[model samples]
Target chain A: MKQEHIQQIGAAVAAVAEKNRINHFYFVACGGSQAFMMPAQYLFDREIETPASIYSSNEFVHRVPKALGQDSVVITCSHSGNTPETVKATEFAREKGATTIALSNVEDSPLWKAAEYPIHYDWGKEADASDLNKGVLYYLIFSVLHAVSPREKYRKGMEAVAGLNDAIEKVKTQYAGIVKEWGKQYKREKLIYTMGSGANYGEAYSFAICLLMEMQWIHSNAIHSGEYFHGPFEVTDYDVPFIMIKGIGATRPLDERAYDFCRKYSEKLMVVDEMEFDMTGIDDQVREYFAPLLAGAVLRSLADEFAYQRGHDLSVRRYMWRMEY
Target chain B: MKQEHIQQIGAAVAAVAEKNRINHFYFVACGGSQAFMMPAQYLFDREIETPASIYSSNEFVHRVPKALGQDSVVITCSHSGNTPETVKATEFAREKGATTIALSNVEDSPLWKAAEYPIHYDWGKEADASDLNKGVLYYLIFSVLHAVSPREKYRKGMEAVAGLNDAIEKVKTQYAGIVKEWGKQYKREKLIYTMGSGANYGEAYSFAICLLMEMQWIHSNAIHSGEYFHGPFEVTDYDVPFIMIKGIGATRPLDERAYDFCRKYSEKLMVVDEMEFDMTGIDDQVREYFAPLLAGAVLRSLADEFAYQRGHDLSVRRYMWRMEY
Candidate 1:
């Protein structure tokens, strides 16, 4: 997380935008990293007229979109920079004549080698890698998109990115006590359901899968608020545990409906509304678009609290990094 | 599930193809029905050169793709034919001048009224609704794709669809005992992890969310086999129950990697390989394409066993249809 890294990514994005009439932007990565880039994808969808997609690395390799070509740009990430599927996908994008960009902590890794442009940033083990990457991606993606569509809103949004660190700090301080209490109360729960809509969907999903299930070994399922009414709502009971991330957006009504119902039915309902956070200096009109980032920052603190309360090390894993899958 | 129904769907698909030159095909639905159409989406991706996309109903409404237009065909499904989102989406597609097709068990439902071509079938309440919808969707999707692409493989595949009932029956009979044993063994477990890749991913996801989690009130998380190694694999332990569906396809290697890793780490690994079932009369080249349907047929029996073992009626629910959200 350095200013030089941000400048480097901005330069690379501008170069790609100048060189090609980009028809598509694809964000490809493995689980946590892919989830990390989802906010960028949502930004592209909501702000830029150009089409953008987020794909799991393995799926992208198997079904390379027909739209991918010389006019396309593919952004991929791997913190270790040697994740096999991501490296392979970056290579494939290059082979297809699409401009490939790689983001990673390791500069000498295979993913870095495969990219036309590699943005290397060293966020130490203590730092939240996803948050740092999200900051970088917002600058990179919005800059490229702004180059294409030339929107004033895009310029304003980029300016707001500089204040994100301060905004996240305020959010963490405000939610620390509540998060800790939640961690202690739900530490022994066997399973929990998480829900979010629009941009916040990715944060809800990654928090459930990566942090809760993967890091803590606690069972959790993330349900899209829009789809919750269809089937997942049937699982709700007076004692069922539920975590909802309410964000400000066009899809806020969808989340609201779920919240209203859960509050009546489930006694163990926890809602982390982005509106509760003070995102100072960010425009109210564009505040909803930043919900994913804000929610991610707050959820990291909750994950930490859960680790502390449950006496489990977040980095301790039985399989990941310990063995070859 | 009937030959006349297949012929009727084929005729409707041909009519749609004849009326408009479809540049894109979009399959949209909610929950289990959305899962039912994934195989069709896969078929369109693998066979036809035209772009195809699968989307959750709510997401499709929020971000209607720029590619959707007079030349686009949108297919949606809802078993009750009253799913508010799907009905609303079909109306939106019609307003956008895209050809809308609806599949449902209720012929007079709002979804049916909104569709340009409504394909309704009365699969009895006792029958597996998803399996029946899969059978109908296969004919509708392949016929439309074949009309555009004119591939001999598609013709041969259509011919094999005639024998699906027998193929499914064989799979059900073979897996019944094993499914029952699994139900009994894992019935007491608080949470289960399910994994599948390629075409079988939908079945794995739907079985976990729509069946185990929703209908039976059990906790389950479906992990894409390719994504399992990315982060979810960290949760693996000696007692963590896992259900892996191994399908035959280009992505089989992804599942194999996960299966190999889980075998070494977790004691509770249950793999349901499609190769174990006899898909009689299906051509070797097309058998892999039918993995989703085959997996769905087998998993239906497993869901039934779980319902019986848990002493929970499949129709029982705390919310969904029990109370308005």
Candidate 2:
């Protein structure tokens, strides 16, 4: 979150990009952490004209792409700084002579020690971890990409990066009441369907899996809106619980179609549209690129409210820390 | 299933490989068909040393990769032969001067007419359309990859292609009884969890979304075994229903880890292990490559039995073909 941290990440990335002729970037992590990296991956692929891939740590270790080499960079994150799969994948990427960057909350953990460049941010459990992680990732990813291809768009985005904290705070404040109400209403739902498309799809996936399923022990499925009608639509009866995160982008129509269909069939439909939130400092032209980050802040409020209404602590787990896998 | 069909597909793929200097491949489709293309995409990335990407048709149309151009090839499939998304994607790919290949059930369908090369197959709805489509894909994909970089391993695999029908039949016969029992036992369960890793992951995804959810109107979630522990595992309890597909591959241990954990917590766990079914004619060394296709045949039997036990016809859909989206 510091200006110095962004400069450090930029310097590290620039050196690697110059030495290795890096053209491909991979963001590797497990579970919710992996989802946090997706918006940056989407930005790199769309805005920077570089190939950016987001991979689950376990899968990346098994099916390491042949395209990865000295000319590639692998960025990994773990809040505890010691997720096994992520540490293993970081090690594997280093073994393949690729540059490895680690983002962790602890400075002395295994993931931090494994990477050539470690971006350590010490944040408390009470803070929204996903929003903090994304804040760092936006700077880390765009810096490296901007260094590779200097453009007016990248420069404009870079100028706006300084105001992201303000923008995120604005989103949280504006959407707090609605988030609390929706979470309270849906707290007892046995099963829920969450839908999104494009960059916001990762946020939708994380909200269902990490927040609802893992934190609250509720059954949830995150369906890509584009693929929703293909099969998942069969479950859309009048009483089905549906939560949709609508973003403004090229994939907006895809989510809109699903939203329209759900309105007709399901009575219990909750939507969090990006257009509803005011990203105060961000320019309208560049708002679509930052939709996921804005949405992540707003969704975290819902997760907190859901935890409160459901009488479940988000940190409590049945098996994750209770026993060894 | 015929030797001549294999040869014809190989010849067509080889010609495209030669003409375009193709180094990138995109498998584009929607829903079950998108899942069908995954194994071929996996094989192309693993064996061919080329960049292979799989995209849902709508996503592909919106975010057509900057890397896609004259040096790229787009392969799509539609069982109904008139999926609007696939037809649009094929047209988009062709506009970008990329070679487009379409596999469809009907010769006169729009999808068939949109492709530069259309591989038409006439198959009844009673047959497992997924298996039939995959059989053609294995030949089409591997042949193009082999032409790009010839190897004895590929040639040996090519020779074994002719015997796939016999291998698939053996799988169906071997697993028939168990499949029927599982269908009968789990017919009343409202929600099911399905997990798979490596190449067979797509089959697990297709089984949950296409067969269980779409056809039977049952609720199911297909979690990647490597990712099962990340969040989905929290939903597991004594009464939870789980159907795990255990495949033999580098990612086998990941599935085994989940299977071991699930057995300890859940009372209801049904496993369809690739090791159980004897792929008679397929060589042991190459067995992992064919795990998905083999698993597909075995799972189709479960879908059939579930339909019978639940007294719901697979073809009866409330919305798919009944209304306009």
Candidate 3:
């Protein structure tokens, strides 16, 4: 991300903190943007005393929590800033006297107009990792965390964010060749399932929903690794395709167990283990929290390779932007 | 549910509320039990001010929230009352000084032994609707809600529970033949998807994970109806088999959009719409909250019918009890 963009995010968060006493946090978005917010929510759930919840944008509007008021901070994101539900959620949150922040790649978007604080992140080929949507969300979340309780993890986390762009790029470069081999090996498969737990579960979900089903039009679903043994594991067999994202930190055991089981029964199993990746740019103290975002970044290479090998353009869609629901 | 079970559940909740300040709530379980707690969590998220969150059993143990304390109330469930993670979680919650409640079909089980409040519900063929797992959960959740905020919804919900057994039975009988027809049509399908939104999403998740995948070893997934528009909707095609549970009240429009789209694209679509059902035993004011549990009860017949038509015994399992994870 450029220095100007980083400065702008800092200023926006600062302004919100000055004007509002944020006792609760509500993160709302749709599709990929929603998936992107999970790690931050997970962090907030563990790291803070105050409540934070993530919701599908429309669900936020439909089931407006009674706690949502002047003390609530509502953060919403949409790539185009025109996603109807998300824009409306921002508007609704503002009307409820909550602090509303909008993140979008588009300049002067509907979400930008609706929210009290609007921050733009960069996207597409020219965008750096810091320029991506996570930059805006991480800045806001970390700022809030620092304000609420200036703990070491939150402080170290903010310092480490500066290195993440390079760290993620390194991981992506390392995975590029491997993903191409994966692309060729698994090109013809029609259905795939992804699984992970804790922080990285969001990456697995995003990979399945946005990368596979939306971008590739391949039937896919994300199974939480901890929850997998409960029921979904019965589907395990030699022909089944599984992508396992083994997270770092406390939940690793859950992913490892699922991985061990999957490797035994499934012939077509792919893994992106955070333990195997070299995240040199990130600080060791805060690396666990960054694993999901890192895993997600590296997996984007896999999606791209799959798109290439399958001869499908990632941007091509049957409905999404092509039709009105 | 029997009168004894009803009385036992009420006393347990009252005891917990008396001993503890009841500041926060945590629901933990595995597989179907975990899915079962979702409706209660959804209701608590909407109905009360004291925050409540649900987690898969193991994740709850691993990521024990900072909020879990002397003032917290944790409710756990496992059909056998022996799910390792759930037992561990109950123990952990108690260790953290939270009042722990365990719901199970089995008496003298690990989870039952671990919790401060252990309530047994009837299961299998002899289990009445009130005697089933829902009896333990619904009563506990309703009683807690009444204690915290005795809103009409909570009081009316308790009164309505008495009639629910008969109402759910009626819905099941009405769908019995319809499910058999569905079983015949969908018998040969190797893969299927289930979708719902709002209150009934838990039913969709439970039906997909526990009913289809675990019991039948079929590859299945639950796609949130609201999320279908985001990415999963791309999977819509003539041959794709989808079972939709349409929720009532606020989020009905979300489910309807997916249903409308899927009906156009998919030939093999089965639906259980709460809007179509005669929920006579339930009060109109609180019917929306009960829709998920009711939908779950009725869909159990669909699962049974599928097992029959597929020539698979629902009791047969490749992993669950057959071998260790």
Candidate 4:
């Protein structure tokens, strides 16, 4: 968000690249944090020769990758900085001689203590557009991208991300009416399915798990557009509630195909199309990668509206952090 | 399968390796076929240096990998050998100069025509355990592993697979009573959720989608066990129906934790523990990898029993091959 934050991320990435060969990148965390890394992983797969993967914190620890050594970077996030497995994962990565970077809302938290580079990203309503957790993730992703391949376009991408708040604000106001309309429709939903493909699939997953299932206590599952035709499509009927995220990416066609099929069958189909979003600052070359960020913003607003319509607090969780597993 | 089938797979893999420098592998298919490739993808991640990825057939075509070139191998499957996307993906890979392999139930089908190597595998009731599509996949996977980095133990793993029919048959007998009981409980159920981790996750997904959703038109989703703790755990309730597949892989503990927690919350929790299955011929070292194959057999049996209990024919489908998407 801020130039200073961008500089800090760049410097951190540069230091890691200087210290390690950095041939592989791993993004490990739990829940929403893990889902948040999907876009970045997709970026790495498309943009760099070095491999990158996202994993649940426990899986990263239990099935420790042989490739995760001195030449690797492991980035983990925990909003509370006290997610046990995430802290353990950061420690495990550090023990394996990998560069560990952690993002949490609390500074010097348990996760921070375990990481070599600790970043505190903003969360909750007070956090402005530029300093949101997604913003920090964009900065970290592009900073790592610059460190790995030093692409001029990637640097431009970071510049776009640096000045996106104005654009983000405009889109939120534009989406408010639709959000209210959809919130009313979704208020009584007992089961809703979110579908998308490519990087946007992460947004769908977050919407399904974090917003619908966790926040509203609704039954939901994130269905990959590419996978919808397989077995999932068979569940389609007139009464099915489906929310589809349509991205303007290479995988857009996959989403379109699924969207086309679903609209014909399901009456309660809501779509959040990236084409409607105003990503004014993002360059044409990398707009597809940032599409998820835009859609995520709209979905977050929709989540808020849904919360209002249902009279449910997004923070009200039956299990998470409330009970020991 | 016949020893010749193993020899044939070995020869094909050897030829590909000798002709090209294979640095990556891609498995592309649709639906059940796509889910089927996940375990082999896991195998490649754990056992080989060359990275392997599984993709829904369309995603493979739409998001064509930059890594897929002369040094890559693409394996695509379409059981009917007529899946349009599967054919196109194989052709795309071959056009990119990657060695392409196609597995189909029908020989000389379109997908086979597009591939550099074409192999047919048995399917349905008449097919023996050793000649099933899964058996063909195992042969192809191990063959590639042998060609990539030959190991005596891996060869032994193959030898174990070579004569696993009696072991598979034995497990079926042991699992029969439980499958019928589960069928009776699951017959009237309209929704089911499956969870598992590591290679065995493919089994969980296949059970959820192919067996439940597509076959019985039940609403179901496969949740990754490692991911179960994050947001999915909040959805667990006393009446929630869960089919958790417990594997003996590196991520088995993740499954165990989810299983333990689910048992406390969900009264309708059914488990197929790999520990309870008979893997008589599969060596201890490789048993974890084969757990999915064993679990898959049991689930397939469970699917059959469910269908009988519900008076729903497993072959009946509302869309697949019956309607155009």
DockQ of each: 0.49, 0.67, 0.75, 0.67
Alpha-carbon local distance difference test for all models: 0.80, 0.81, 0.84, 0.83
| Interface root-mean-square deviation (Å) of every model | 2.3, 1.5, 1.1, 1.4
Candidate 1: CAPRI quality band? medium
TM-score of each: 0.93, 0.96, 0.97, 0.97
Candidate 4's displacement at residue B11, Å, is 3.2
How well does model 3 score by local distance difference test? 0.84
Measured as a fraction from 0 to 1, the native contacts recovered by model 3 come to 0.65
Model 3, residue B218: distance off in Å is: 1.7
Score residue A221 of candidate 3 by CA lDDT. Answer: 80
Error of 4 at B191 (Å): 1.1
Q: Which residue ranges in model 2 land beyond 4 Å of their true spot?
A: A125-131, B1-8, B19-23, B125-131
Full candidate order by TM-score, most accurate first: 3, 4, 2, 1
Q: Please, what are the lDDT tens digits per residue for candidate 2 over residues B236-313?
A: 999999888888876788889999999999999988888877766666656777877888877888889889999998
B316 in model 1: Cα distance from truth in Å? 2.0
lDDT (Cα, tens digit) per residue for candidate 1, span A185-295? 888886778899888888988988899878988778788887787777877888888889988876777888889988988899888997788978776666887767878
Chain A TM-scores in order: 0.95, 0.94, 0.96, 0.96
Clashes of each: 0, 0, 2, 0
TM-score of chain A of 3: 0.96
Model 1 sits at a Cα RMSD from the real structure of 2.7
Which pairs clash inside model 2?
none
